[model samples]
Target: MSTSDAVTTQSPALSSEDRSARIAVTVFPLLILAAFAIAMITPDTFKPLAPGVNWALGVIMFGMGLTLTLPDFGLIVKRPLPVLVGVVAQYLIMPLVGWALCYVFGLPDAVAVGVILVGCAPGGTASNVISYLAKADVALSVTMTSISTLLAPLMTPLLTAWLVGNRMPVDGAAMDILLMVLAPVLGGFIVRFVAGKFVEKILPLLPWISVFGICYVLLVVVSGSVNKILTSGALIIAVVICHNLLGYLFG
Candidate 1:
């Protein structure tokens, strides 16, 4: 092909939605780090927000829902192999690696259980933004994230119980998971399905909303464990990094 023709056929500029996703992926982690630092320094300030952690999570999940369209889920049917592979790998690998790491480090009971919980949990909403930024299959990313999140109440509790029951009590509340994760997601989907074009107009804003919600969640989580974070923050951070890198590598 001629140079001019090749240039002309190059992909168009990123849509505003994709641009927003990239921006979110870049900014959200910085925001979380900031929140974590602030909470460690001023635990009391964020302790009051602890009660609302579930609420903040719900908001984030809802924003995730708002970005979804029925067609996104259709990717599951159209491209079943990749989708199933991603989903199964996500649910299985992360948790197993997390459980293994707990023993490797001989982690304290509380920290060990916490790591397992993190592993048992599904993919976060931010994965969609990261996938978009990485030029990965955004639709497959969303579907995997959504499916795994929907399965959390069942899978997380079961996995945690099996992996950590002897070390710590596992009282998984299905209701809490339903309220925090499922309800808002379903509500967002319903709104998008019902509002159609109107929801499209606000799609660019959803990432920011999710970012805010996640930062708030960090604040609450850190505030509740300020002393633990302050005393073992470095160790926790190391374990978390190892866990995350291993999950990605395995996945």
Candidate 2:
């Protein structure tokens, strides 16, 4: 094929993926709202799925791992400063902003703890997709996500204890991080490293798997708190909006 034909043939696939990523970002928030409504309307329907929540989360993390390659980490060495700054900002600014918002709004302890936990959490894999869609530096996004996730076991737990422990006990934060974040990711990375060619074959399906897993987990979580959500969902949504917006602004 000529050069133009080669470029033309490849462009459609690349553009398709970009388009899908953009659609996902736009659709995710609406999906969350829909999940919440479903939970509130029929709590018992989802409560039975609670036992599967951990497994769903694990699948999501494993999907993240499958998408990763060892070379992705080299971005850290290629541009250390930006990666370091992003990591530091991810860990520092968001937690402080979350803490400040909690106080300013006088959020209930349960809600305050949730906000703090989100702040303490590492950069999510979705950011990589969003970066790709926005034509940002996908490598940098991946590096920041990988580093902060590796650091979550140490940073998330300690930060949660320090910032949120006063309001409530943060027992087993380290354990939670280990089980929820580190183990599955490490397992996925190891599988990818060992079976990269096979992993690549299934890579296109991983994102959809992750989306389904997350949706299931959200359903279970929302079901568990259906009553609270029925009463205070609006306030909770507002707080989440504020937390996310302020976090972006602060970062």
Candidate 3:
């Protein structure tokens, strides 16, 4: 082939990667925009969809379970101490930090509970990816996040009740929530155990599934926020930003 033709052929290949990178960059912001647009366009319509948050959470957990195996559990059994430390850190650090922010910033009751709820919640599945990107201990991170998440039904409600229950009236029946969350996860794990090769083949798409799930949850939350935003406006934004930034700093 002529040199010019060779370069021309390669140019298309290079542009494909560039296009993918651009899409990846824009996808999240676009999702955020769509979420806000939905919130504005049909706020009441999305209210009924709120229950889907729990379902989406379950699906995300199941995806996490699908990525696991017997060996992952064995790794936890083999090295209990570090895993224990990470789990403890995950539970205590985030909630306490959130509580302190509530007091320090003087957040009102409802917003304060929201902050505590997110904090009391277990480390997200995304933390494993973050740990990997940071070149930290991926296995340990996964183990800690998994164990903490598995325990979230009990721990999350309990901690939230104890800390912010008075403010927001937290229901202490965490076993119910736990069942809802873990059933899909355990089911996924069972599927992985029975069909390892099949699970492996589809594992590559799990992250995208998770991204979609997160976008759904964000939509629900933002939709809920529309009324509050309309009433409170920038003050709500300031409070939420403060809560999120503080949670990240302390988390």
Best of the candidates, TM-score? 1
247, model 2: CA deviation in Å? 0.4
Best candidate per lDDT, number? Answer: 1
Please tell me which model should have the higher TM-score, number 1 or number 2. 1
Per-residue lDDT tens digits for candidate 3, residues 1-251, read: 99998888773443432343345445756776787788777877777889898888788767767766788778868889998877887678778877887888787887788778887887664565334333355456666766786787678878888888553344554555556445766788899999999887776566556657767877787778787778866765676677667656765
Across residues 49-87, which tens digit of lDDT does each residue of candidate 2 receive?
Answer: 888877777777776666666777676577699989999
Steric clash pairs (candidate 1): none
Instruction: Supply candidate 1's per-residue lDDT for 172.
Output: 55
- Total backbone collisions for each predicted model: 0, 0, 0
For all candidates in order, the CA lDDT equals: 0.78, 0.75, 0.70
List candidate 1 stretches off by more than 4 Å.
1-10, 124-154, 165-172
Candidate 2 lDDT score at position 152? 78
Ranking by lDDT: 1, 2, 3
Candidate 2's C-alpha runs over 4 A off are: 1-26, 108-114, 121-170
lDDT of 2 at 169: 42
Q: Positional deviation of 167 in candidate 3, in angstroms?
A: 9.7
Report the lDDT of model 1 for residue 159.
85
